[model samples]
Target: MAVPALDTARAAPHTRPAPAPRPARRPGRAAVALAPAGLALALGLWGIRRENSMWRDESTTYQVAHRGVADIFHLLGEADVAHGLYYLLMHGVFALWDGGLLALRLPSVLAMAAAAAGVALLGHRLAGPRTGLAAGAVFALAPAVQRYAQEGRSYALVCAAVVWSTHLLLSAVANPRGRAWAGYAAVASVTCLLHEFAVLAVLAHGVTLLLARVPAPIRWAWARAASAVALVLAPLVIVSQQQAALVGWIGRPGQTELLGFLALTAVGLGCAVLPLRTSAAISLRTLALPLLILPAATLLAVSFIHPIYVDRYVLYSYAGFALLTGAGLEAALRAAPHPRAGAAALAAVAVAALLPYSIELRTPQSRLDDPMAAARAVRELTRPGDGVLFMPARRREPIMSSPGEFRGLKELALAQHAVPSGTLHGIELSAPRIRARMMTAERIAVVTDPPGRRPDDTPQERTKREVLAQHFRRCAEREVQGMVVLLYARPGAC
Candidate 1:
C-alpha cells in the first residue's frame, strides 16, 4: 500500500540482480588455477624412483650438502661457487630428513610444481586463463622441465623463482607501488642468488617493458626494481666470476646448441604470429617473445668473447617457451570447430610426444655419468684391503661420494679424504708417493674416466700409469656406464 502497488514490470527491467552471480564460473576458474600445479606434482612424482642412482652432478650435490655447513661454505670458496646457495638450501633439507635419494631430489620436485603454478599464473596475466592453464601444463610436460624436476639441482628452483618474479613484475608494472616493486625486487634477487645466470631474466623483463605501451611511471618503477635486483646480486656475481675455472670445461657453443636455439626461435616466432588475444598495454607476444629468445641469445653472443653459454644455465627460458606454446595451442583450438575436443587432442599428442623422452630420462643413460652405478660396480668387485687408484685423479669423485663402497680399501693416491679436506675430489699425494704406494700393493682396483677420453698427461697421472704397468698385470677389467674399472694384481697372482 505504501509503495502504491509498485510498477512491477518496470522494476523487473531495472532489478534483474546481475544474473545470479555465476557460481559455475567460480569452479571453472578454480580448476584452471589449480590444474598446472596438479599436473606438475603428478608428473614430478611419477618416476621419482625410476632414476634411483644419483648421477655425477647430483652426487656432487649430495656430497657437498652432506658436509658440515662450515665445510660447505669453505669448499664453495675453492670450487662450486655457482651451486653454493643451492647446497646451503639442501643442507637444511638433509638436516630435516636424510632418507637417501628421495630426500635429496624431493625439493626439486616441489620447486618445479610451484614453478608450474607460477607459469600458469603468469600466462593468465599476460594472455588469459586458458593460456595460463595450457602454459602450465606444457611446462610440466616439457622434457627439460621434467629432467630437472626429478634431478637434485638448483635449475628447477631457479626456474620457479623466475616465473614467480615475472608474475610479480607484471603486477608491479600494472600497479606501480613501492611495495609491489619491492616484492618484484626481492623475488628476482632470490632467483639471481640461486643462480647468477638467472639475472638474465631481468633483460627479458626490460624488453617487455620497452615494447609495451606503459605509462612513464610504470617503466621507471620497473627500471628501479631491476636496478635494485642487480645491486643485491652484484656480490654473488663477483664471487662467481672469481670461481670461473669451475666452468672451464664448457667449450664454445657447438652445432647442436645452434640447432636447438634455432628450433626455439622458430617456436617462439610461430606463437607470436598466431592470432591470440592480448592486451594492448602489454601483449603476450611482447613478453613471451623476448623472454624466450633474449637470455639464451645474449649468453650465446657473449660466448664469442667468453665461452659462458651452457643450455642448462638458462633453464628458466623454457618457461617462456612453455607460455608461447600454450598460447599457440589455445589459439589453434579456439580456431577449430570444436575447441574442447581440439584441446584434448592436442594434449594427447603432447603426452605421446613426451612419453619416450620421459622414459629415457628415467634410465641411467640419461645422465653423463652414473656415480651410483660406479659405486655398485666397485662394491661388487673389490674385497677389503684392496688398494684403490683413480687413474686421472678426478675419477676419485664417484668413490668419494660413496665412501662406504670403498670403506676398507686403501685410497693409494689420496692425501686427504674429501670430508676432511673440504674438497670435491680429495687432494692427491705427490707423484713419488703414489708410485711408492703402487709398488707395495699386491692387488689394486682402478677407476678411470670412460674409454676414449683424452688421457691425462700430467706427471702424477703419468707416474700412476707407469707404476701400474711395471708392477702389476690386468687381472680383470669391467666397464660401467661412464667409467672403467680395472683390477690389477702382481704377475701370476689373480
Candidate 2:
C-alpha cells in the first residue's frame, strides 16, 4: 500500500523558517586591488616637491633628455649606452611639460605606484589577499623605494617592469598559454633595456622554475620566452659592456654594505621558511625565495670579477623581500586572538618606523649633490663677463640644468656644448687652451666637488686648478649643498 504523502507545501513554511541572511556584499576584487596603487601614488607624491633640487644624476637626465632626438641617439652611442631607453622615455615626458622638479620626477612616482601594485598582485597570487596588501604596504614604506620614486631615474621604471614580468610569468605557468609567454618576454626585454643590470632577474626566475619543476610544456614556454628576451637584449649587453668604464667608480662592497646584505638575507630566509598556508600548486617560498636572494647573490658573486654590485641595481629584489615579509606578517596576524587589531597594530608600527626615513628622503642632504642650490649660489656670486671654470670638468653638470645662471659668464674650458660634444659635461678645451683662458680672465667663478674629495686630475682639470692657483688668488669661497663655489681674481685685484 502507498504511504500517505506528507503535505510538504504545508510544512515548508515552518521547516524552511527565514532564509539565512545573505552575507553582506564585500568590496569587489577590482576595488580591493586598487588599494595598493592608490597608497603608492599617495606616498610617492607626498613631499615630492620638498626635495626640489636635482642631484648630479638627475641633472644628467635633464641635460640628456632636453636634447633633440637625433642628438640624444648620437650621444647614446658614445656615452650612457645603458640608459638609452630611459632617456628616450624621458624625452617624451619632457616634451610634454618641462616645468619644475615635479615634471621631472612625476614619471618615477607613477612607475613606483605601478610597481607597488604589481608586487601586491604577485604576493596575492603566490600567497593570499592579506599577504598581497602587506607586501604593497611595505614596498610603499621602503626608504629606497621612496628615494628613487621622487628622483628622475630609470630604476623605478625597471623595478615596475620586472615585478609585472614576474606576475606574467606566474600567469604563463598557470595557464601555459603562448600569448602569456610572449607578454612575459616583451616585459622582461623592456625591463632589461631600461637598465641592463635588470637582466640579472632572469637568473632569479630560473631558480624559481627549477625549484618548481614545472610541467614540460610550461618549462618549454619559459625557455622560449627567456631565449627571446636574451636575443633581444644581446645588442644592449654588448654595447653596455663596451661602455663599462661608466661604472668604474663603483668600488668593492664595503663592510657596512656586506653586513647589511647579510641581515637582509637572514630576514628573507626566515620569512621564506616560516610555515604559512599557501597555494599547494605554488608555494610562496618557491616564488619569493629566489627573487629575494638570487639576483643580489649573483650580482655580489660577480662583483669579485667586476665591481658591479650596487644596491640600487638590484632594487627589484625588494619586491621579493616585501612579499616574504608580508606573508610572515599575515601569518602572525592570523595567529593572534584579534586578527584585525593585530594587523592594525603591525601597520601602525611600520608607519612609525618609516616616518623618519620618509622625511629624510625629502631633504637636499639625502642626495649626492643638490644641483639647484649650487646653481642658485653660482647665480648669486657670478658677474657679467666672469669666466666660469668647472674644476674636474664634470662639476659643470649643475649649470647645464640651469644654463641661465651661467649665461653671460663664459665657460672657460668648454670645447662645445654638452649635446654637440656628446658628453655628460661639455668636452673640455685643451689643457693649454684652458690655461690661456684662465690667464686672460680678470675674474673667474669656480665650481668644484665637495671639500676633501680629490679631483679627477685629468690634464685639463689639473691645468684649471694650477692656472687659478698660480695666476689668481681665491677672493671668496662659499660651500653649497654638495659643492664649493669660489671667486678667483688676479693677484692683488681682490
Candidate 3:
C-alpha cells in the first residue's frame, strides 16, 4: 500500500459529512455558551483596575515601553526577556496609549478573552460543539488565566496564540493538506512573535503530527511549520546573553512546590474541558490527567536538572493540554452507552473541582495583586526633595528594577519625580546602617507585604520588616488599603 499522495488526498472526495449550518439553537443557547465567557472577561477586566500597584515586573514593563524604540532595541541588543518580543510590542503600546495600569493592561485582557473563544473553537473542532462551548466557558472561568489576562504581560497573549496554533495543529493532523499546513504557518508565526517559549508548542505539534503517522506531505507540512519558526527565531538568537541572564535564577523549585505549580496548570486546563462531556457517561478521567497527572509528571521530570520549575514557563503546555483533555472527555461522553450518567459524572467533577478553585478566587490573595500602586501612590504623595528610601529596599527592588508600567515607576522617573539618594538595601544590614539611612531621609518608606514577602523569596528577606523596625523609629505607617505602605522617618528627620 503506497502512502497516499498529498495531491490524491486533496482530490479525494469529502467523506466526513459537512456540518449543517443548523438554524440557530433556541434563543438562549448562544447566550449560554457565552455567559461564562462574558462574566469571566468582565470580572477579569474589573480585577486589573487595581492590579497595577507598581510591582517590580509591571514597573519594568511600563519603563521599557516608555523608552524610544531605538533605545528599546539597544536594550534588547543588551539583555532581553523571553526574546524581547513583548517589550518591543509594549514600546509601541506605551507610545499610543496611556501607560496607566488599566490602559497598559487592556490588551492582555482582550487577548485572554480571545483565547477563551479559541479554546471553545478548538474544543468544538476536536470533540464537538458542546465540547467547544464547554471549553470556552471553562477557559473564561479559569482563575490563573484570568489573573494573567488582566495584567500587562506576555502570558495572556501567548495563551491566545497557543490556542490558535493548537487548532491549526489539530486541523493539519486531521486533514493533512497544504492549506492546513498553511494555517499552521500563519498561527505559528504569531506565536513566535508573542513568545519564544511558544517554540516548545511548535515542537509538541511536530510530535503530535508524527504520531498521527500521516503521509510524507503531512510530515513535510509540520517540517515547514518548524522551519518557519526556526527562521523567525534566528534573529532573536542574537540576544542570547539577555535571555540567559533573565533565566539565570532557576533555583530548584522544591519537589512539592514544583508539583504544586504543575497541578495549578492542570486545574486550569481541566476546567476548560469538563462541561463538554457526553450526555450519558460519567467520570472525571478527562479532567484528571493532563490537568493533573501529565503536568505533575512533566514538572517532576523537568525539575531535576537545574529545575525547570516556573509556572509561567510552561504556559504553552497548559493550554494545549487542556484542549486535548477536553476533547478526550467529549469523546468519552459521546461514546458512553450511558450518556446521562456520563453527563452527571462530569457535572459532579466540575462542582467538586471548581469548588476549590472558586474558593481560591474569593480569597484575599486574588485581590492583593497591586504591584504598581506603590509608585503611583508615591507620585501622588511626594513633594520636591521628599527623600524616598525603600528601607529593606530588597523588597522594592523588583519594583524599582524594571522602573516602568511593569512597575509604574518608569513614567515617574521619566518625569524626574524621586531621587535614589539612600536605601537600606536588605534586612541583613546592621540596625545602625538602616537607622542612619532612615534618619537622614526626610520621607522614608518600606515596601513590604504585612503577611510576608513573595513566598518564593529567601527566608532572610522575609525578615525585612522586623529587622528595619528595630533601627528606624516608626514615624508614620500608611496602609494603602491592601499593600503595606509603611511610612517611617529617620529617628527624627525634621
Top-lDDT structure, candidate number: 1
TM-score of 2: 0.94
Global lDDT of model 3: 0.57
Roughly what TM-score does model 1 have, to 2 decimal places? Answer: 0.93
User: Which lDDT tens digits does candidate 1 get at residues 1-494?
Assistant: 64644777668878777755543342244666578888888888887865577777888888888989999988877778878889999999999999788888889899999999888877777778888898888888888889999988999999999988888888887778899999999989888989998988988998888888688788888888889988988878788888888788888899999899989889989887889877436788888888889999999999888999988899889888988989998899878999878888887888898899889888888878777777778788889889989888877766867878888998899888777776788788899998898888989998988778998898889998898888899988878778888899999988
- How much lDDT does each candidate structure score? 0.85, 0.84, 0.57
CA deviation > 4 Å runs, candidate 3: 1-40, 51-54, 173-183, 235-238, 241-243, 261-300, 324-364, 367-369, 376-384, 391-443, 446-474, 478-494
Per-residue lDDT of model 3, residues 1-494, tens digit only = 34567756876676556878986453234543465457557757664655334344555566666666666665665455453678777777767876577667788878877777776665555445666665566566656775677666788888778777766766676677788878788778777767665676676666555544557677787898789778877676656644565566677777667566656655555554545443211122332233333443555566677455566655545455545555555566768999669878887887698667655553335554444555555555544544444433434543453344132222111112212221112124444444444444455445555555454343333343444465455655555534565555445752
The root-mean-square deviation over C-alpha atoms between each candidate and the true structure, in angstroms, is 4.6, 3.3, 12.0
Q: How far off is residue 290 in model 3, in Å? A: 8.4
Show where candidate 1 strays beyond 4 Å: 1-29
Residues 161-251 of candidate 2 have per-residue lDDT tens digits of 9998988888888888788899999999999989987878876887788899887777777888889989989999888888889889998
Q: Pick the candidate with the highest TM-score.
A: 2
In terms of lDDT, which candidate is stronger, 1 or 3?
1
